[model samples]
Target: MSLIKFFVLAQLKVEQFIKETEGASGIEYAIIAAMVAVIIIGFSSSIQNGISAIFTKIQAALPAASS
Candidate 1:
């Protein structure tokens, strides 16, 4: 009888552990989002410079309007 009770308790503990681990998926997604945000922030200056260069080129190619 004692052995049976021990097994039941062990099973309950295992179930609790499984339930706690279910949050891991959410944590994984949060980690991925943070990494992507970090990467974007790291490249932001380069992206801005590229965009600025493209616009400058376009402006230079356009003829100035006469007054």
Candidate 2:
């Protein structure tokens, strides 16, 4: 999508959030969700490599099953 469209959508959401009487919980939830997503994306590569190494080690240690 175009940057303008993205900005418009974001502005609308922000306005709605601001207008709500009980907005603190909603904002807190959004912030927590965003932080969790950032953490997962940051660590995902390391986690993937660790899991790959573990599987490789297990395969090397296991003998081939009889046919």
In terms of TM-score, the best-performing candidate is 1
Q: In candidate 2, what are the lDDT values of residues 1-67, reduced to their tens digit?
A: 9999999999999999879878789989999999999999999999999999999988877766432
Candidate 2 lands at a TM-score of 0.62
Give residue 66's lDDT in candidate 2 (0 to 100).
Answer: 32
How close is each model in CA RMSD to the real structure? 4.2, 12.1
Give the lDDT of residue 3 in candidate 1: 95
Q: What TM-score, computed on C-alpha atoms, does each candidate reach?
A: 0.66, 0.62
Model 1 lDDT tens row, 1-67: 6999999999999999988977899999999999999999999999999999999987877766432
Q: Give the Cα lDDT of each candidate.
A: 0.92, 0.92
lDDT of 1: 0.92
Q: What is the lDDT of residue 23 in candidate 1?
A: 86
Of candidate 2, the 10-residue stretch with the lowest lDDT total is: 58-67
Point out where model 2 deviates above 4 Å. 1-21, 64-67
